[model samples]
Structures are given as C-alpha cells and as structure tokens.
Target: MFLDNEDKISIDRVVEELENRPELQHVYLHKLFKRDHHKGQRYHEKQISLYAEYDRPNLLPFLRDSTHCPLEKALEICQQRNFVEETVYLPSRMGNSHSALKMIMEELQDVDKAIEFAKEQDDGELWEDLILYSIDKPPFITGLLNNIGTHVDPILLIHRIKEGMEIPNLRDSLVKILQDYNLQILLREGCKKILVADSLSLLKKMHRTQMKGVLVDEENICESCLSPILPSDASKSFSVVVFHCRHMFHRECLPVSNTVSSVQFCNICSAKHRGPGSAVLEMKK
Candidate 1:
C-alpha cells in the first residue's frame, strides 16, 4: 500500500504500517520515540526488545532523547554499551550537565573522575557543591583537597561554610581543609616575593651598567662641535667630560645645563653619564 506524504498521518496508522514490515519497525519506532517519548518508550521496551542486541546503539539515542528515561537508566545503558562519554545529555535535567556527571561519578565512588570533572568545569559554585557534599567523607575530602584545592579558590568555599556553619559537626574537618588552603596561598605569595626580588636585583645590575663610565678611546670625539679630544691636552684649561660609552666632549662644549652632574646624558651617544667624578660634581653642587 502506498502511504500518503501528509502531516495528518495518525501515530496508530504509522505503527500499523511498521507492524506489517518488521524490518522497518525499529526505524519507525525510533522516529516515533523522537516525536512522543512516553508512548515510544513503551513500544521500545515491549516490541523493540526482540532486536535489542543488534539495535541497542539505535535505541540509545532514543533513550537519550526520551524525557521519561531516568538518569539512572540512561547511565546503566551507557555503562552496558560503554557510551558514557558519547552521551552528552546523560545528566538529564536535574542539574548542570557537568555537575550531574560529577554526581554520577561520585555515586560510582570514582573520586578521581569526579575531581577531574569538577576541575574541567572550573566553576567555583560547582566545586563548592562538591566540597559541601563530600565534607562528611574524610577520604573523599582529603583526595579533593590534595588534587584540586590549589587549583580552585578555597577562600570562597571557606567563606560559604563560615556563613552557614550548618555542618558544625564537621568543624574540625573543615578547619583542616582551611589549613591546607592557607598553606597553598602562603606558597604562592612566597613565590611571587621571590620573583619580585630577583627582578629588582636584575634591574639594579642593568642600571649600574648603564651609568658606569669608560675611558675615552682614540676614535672618541666631541659630537656637539665635532672637535677632537686629545689625551695630551687632558691637563689643559679646557676640561673634558668622558661619557659612559667613551665619547668625550669639552665641558664647555657640552649641552647648556645648570651643572656637570645636571648633564645626566652624553652629548655623543646619548648614554647616561656617570662616574666617581660625576658624584664629586654632584657633591660640589
């Protein structure tokens, strides 16, 4: 019989057509499952059970889409078919998907998996939820703090716990968790201080190098007036100023400034000028 391509086709007629052809039963049922989860699931559980082993993979998608399918049931299917990672909506609508996966991992008593999921999410609120839920379980708390405490901000969680204080029974355990958090913070600050000190030391060394003066060489000449500074005329009335780069210029030929020390830069290379004599000049000022 030819089927009309009409939108008004009843679900009963569609099912009857698939019933006449057993080969198309799973495919049509899956389509119906996608359309109406409640009825489709009922048919899937009853009629689809015959081809379940061969058609399980096809059935998983329908189960994943079915609102009637409980998270526990979906998880069981995932475990049986090893499709946990493949099913994106395995958590259902109870909570955030990642948080729900974390809960599932926790239920399975897979602490590492739950911690890894929590870290991947990088949500402070989710981490806090995991912390609050696992508080009474000392072993789980220890593992969480050891693995992820440094990666997340414990201060926020601590503040939350302090505000509520509902779980006063676990106060000592909470205090221990805070101690680990404080230790992590202290180590981080210590590292920053060390980095700052090293940076300052390196900067001081660079400054000293930039300010150190060198003796004038044969090629050294005054840049301002293009005059040669002769070593034989060193004792002459014309005073010479040797810059950090060995570029020499007559003091009178230097840039017009208040004092020699005030002339903080070279007239030749523009390098900063400094020496024992520059300090003496500053003292004279």
Candidate 2:
C-alpha cells in the first residue's frame, strides 16, 4: 500500500481545466494565486507552464509578483510567443539587464523607452550602451539630445553623432539644453541666497533674545541647589545662570567643565540635547 500527496493531482486537474477553457483562466488563476499562495513549487510551476503556452494578457503580471516561478523557463516561453515586453522585463528582473536593454534598442527600436529604462535603472554602463545604440540612428540621436543636461550630458552624445547625419530639431534641442543649464544655475543661486538670509535672520533673532534681561528677584530660586537665588542680607552677593527656558541655578551649584566651548545643558529644560539634562555651566554673573 502507498500514499501520495494531493497537491499534484489537484494542480494537474486545475491546469487541464484552465487549458480546456481559456475564457475562465484569469478568474481561476486569480483564485489559485490568492487561496493557494503558499501551495509550494508545484503550484508556481503550473502557473509558469500555463503562462508560456497561452497568451493570457494578465499572466506576466502575476508571474512578475510570484518569486516561486522559474525565470529561465518563463523567459523561454515568453520569447517563443513573441511576448516582447515580457522577455525584456524578465531578463532585467533576472539581473541580465544588458540583454534586456539590447532587446529594447535593437528588437523594439523604441529610443524613448530605451532611454527611460536606462534612466530608471540609473546605471552608467546602461547609459553608455544606449548612447552607442543611438549613435547610428538620427531620430534616436535627436531623442537623446532633448534629454541633455537632465538624464545625460550633451558632450557625450554630440561627439558620437555621425558627421553627415541630420538630426531632427537639432537647433531646438541645443537651445533647450542651454536653457535648462541656465535655469539650474539660477535655481542654485536663489537657494544659496535664501539659505544665507535665513541663517543671518536667525542669528539676529538669537542675539536679541540673549540681550533681553531676565527678572531675577527675591522670589527666584535655584533649580539645581533648590535654595534662594538672592539672599535676604544686603551685604552678600552671589552669581547665577538663567536659561532661555527660565531655569536658574547658582554658579557654584552647576558642574565645572575643562573645555571653554563645551555646551552648558540646563538640568531642567533640555528637549534637544537628550540625556537627563546634566547641570548647566555658569553663563551669567
């Protein structure tokens, strides 16, 4: 007596039903994907096989999301079926980006798409490959020229252009590139001015705040020592430091630092410096 797994029989039956009724493949496939998401490798293999044999429009998108599908097997079927987009996407997803980019350049002959794919990947080698492919085609050359100063440099593409070839909208593309460069320079200058002005304005505001006197009367008490900041006797006088947060401490009650420029953190109000607010240094006398 022998026992066998049920998944194989179930998947085989589902595949046959899907193959026999092409109209309901997507619905059943969606159900299979959702209900049996973790139905193991057997489930994914069935999906891959169905996608390769039939031109189910929604097949690749499902395959794209499933990591269980064998990429090499899927690509082979997609290529045979003339599924150009799938072939390109599958190779790229499999890390064979050079092959995918080649198909986009030679097989698809779509200059804009090839450039956009290169930009999205943001690979220098891909840009070089695109530039080399575009060199011989005047229309491709024109398309790349329009993207200069943004996705690519004009010098790189311009020197590659054939001497006798006439590119479409050549003068207009150059003008646009120059305008883009000028606009970028102006933007940088404006940003610099705004940043500097903001810095100066903040500094001036901080100076004014520092100049404003704090009311240190007999009612005031030291936050650190928890004693009267000003003694009732008129003959004696002591120093104190007052923070912008209005926390006061006696000069001798706070910790002493060896570094002259070390930050003085208030023991009370310190929302920025983290820690449990170490004792503040003597800032006022």
Candidate 3:
C-alpha cells in the first residue's frame, strides 16, 4: 500500500497515512521531496520543527538528509540540546564549518591547540605536558623556559631536568639549566667559606693571647689549669714546662710523650719552645 504517482490523494493525505509508519516515513518523504519541490520544502520544514521538539537524537541525521535543512539551524539545535559529542560530527555534515571544526579539534584533544590554550589560560597541567613533549628538543625547551620560567616551579623544572639526564639529546639543555641553578649555590657556599676563614683568624688571635700568658692580680696563671704560677713555688718548679710563647703549665698537664722530639711547639700558639732540652730553671728574684 505505497503511495505512487497514480494515487489521486493530496500530499497532506499521503503524509498523514505514512505518519504512523516510521519505517515507511523516510522513504515516502524522500520520494515526495524528489517529485514535488514545493511540497518537499514544506515537509522538510515540518520535519525539522518536529525533530527539534521531540526527536533530538534523530535531528542531525534528519537535517543531513533534508535538502531544505540549514546547517546553522542544526548547530543551534545541537547547542540547545547540549549535544557536545554530536557537535564533533557536525562539521563533516556541514562541509567543514570552521567553528564546528575547532569544536571537534578541541574535543579530540588537539595538541597544538591545547598548548596554545594552556599558554593563553596559564594552565600548569597543560604546560607540563608541553614541557614533557619538548624534552628531546633543546631549542624548544630553551624557548619554553624563557617564556614560562616565572610561571613554572623552578624546583620541579630542575627535577625534570635531572630525570632527563639519561637522554643524550637533552644533555646539553639539562647541563645549561643545572649550571645556572648551581651557580647560585656555589656563590652561597663561597660566602660561607669567607665567613669561616674570618672566624678562624679571630680564633687564632685569641689562642695566641691565651698562650702568651694569663695575668691574675699581678700573678701569672697557668692557661691549662687556671692555677697561679708563683715564682716562690720553688718545690713545684721542676713540675712545670714553659713554652717559647712565655706560657707555663704543669708537666703533667702538657701533652708530652716520654720520648722527647727534636722540637715541641706550644699546643696553643703552635710555636717551637726554645731552650735546653731538660734544664732546671733558676728564677730571678
């Protein structure tokens, strides 16, 4: 019971007959559009409106097959329906509309556009991907570092370079980044060395003073034991060792071995003691 050229029924009556049969609807509509141009435009518009109202799933295919359906109208309907995935395929049906193509590219994760968008938006995660992608390309990394150095985490960047050390192509770039990073560390260490040297010089001067002598109430005190070295203590005189620095200490207090060496320097001033090897001293009154 198909409608044909021989049928005397009006197009409205034929369409009404096919309304209940979805399988035959497309066939009848396609034939009607091919046969009667005026009626076809009316039927196409009516189908577009009905699809927009109740058949969003079939809207794209309907629009694609209909001669009178506008691409802009399809895009609008997709937007209204929030059909993001469907929009991706709309460009092919619409002969590569630029906006549709861009939407599809973005949805498909176009690397170049992703990087560009990330840079524009200052997105760290996307920049990280771009950085990893440029690992083997030194020139690109140099440019990337120069451009985004302030925005990126330098510590993370350093860590990335360290991990890239095994890559032969990345070696030069890694070295350059490391050199700049280490230069600051070296300068900091250099300053620490200078401070240490200054402290050591001050400590040496104080040590020299301690070795020279300690005067207590017009009396000389032994530096090691802080005891008075009285000239009147003749009995204990043999128990003392005086260094060339003019400091005296009990022989037991001084770090000396049973074997006398050719020269023994004061532990404090580090100066060699000058005199007889083991001569008994006679103090002047």
Highest lDDT model number = 2
Ten-residue region with minimum lDDT total, candidate 2:
271-280
Candidate 1, 160-258: lDDT as tens digits: 434443443355655667787788789999999999999999989976875665655446566667766544554554466655455556667766752
Q: Which portions of model 3 show Cα errors greater than 4 Å?
A: 16-39, 49-61, 89-96, 108-285
Global lDDT of model 1: 0.58
Model 3 CA lDDT for position 213: 46
Native-referenced Cα lDDT, model 2: 0.73
Model 3, 71-164: lDDT tens per residue? 6666666677777755655664666544443563446444444345445556566567666755565554555544453456555554566443
Q: Model 1, which residues run further than 4 Å from truth?
A: 1-111, 117-148, 159-173, 185-213, 223-238, 243-249, 258-263, 266-285
TM-score of each: 0.41, 0.65, 0.29
- For model 1, give the 10-residue run with minimal summed lDDT: 276-285
Q: Output the TM-score of candidate 1.
A: 0.41
Q: Please say which candidate is ahead in lDDT: 1 or 3.
A: 1
lDDT of 1 at 153: 61
**By descending TM-score, how would the candidates be arranged?**
2, 1, 3
Give the alpha carbon lDDT tens digit for every residue of 11-47 in model 2: 5566566676754564465566765666545667666
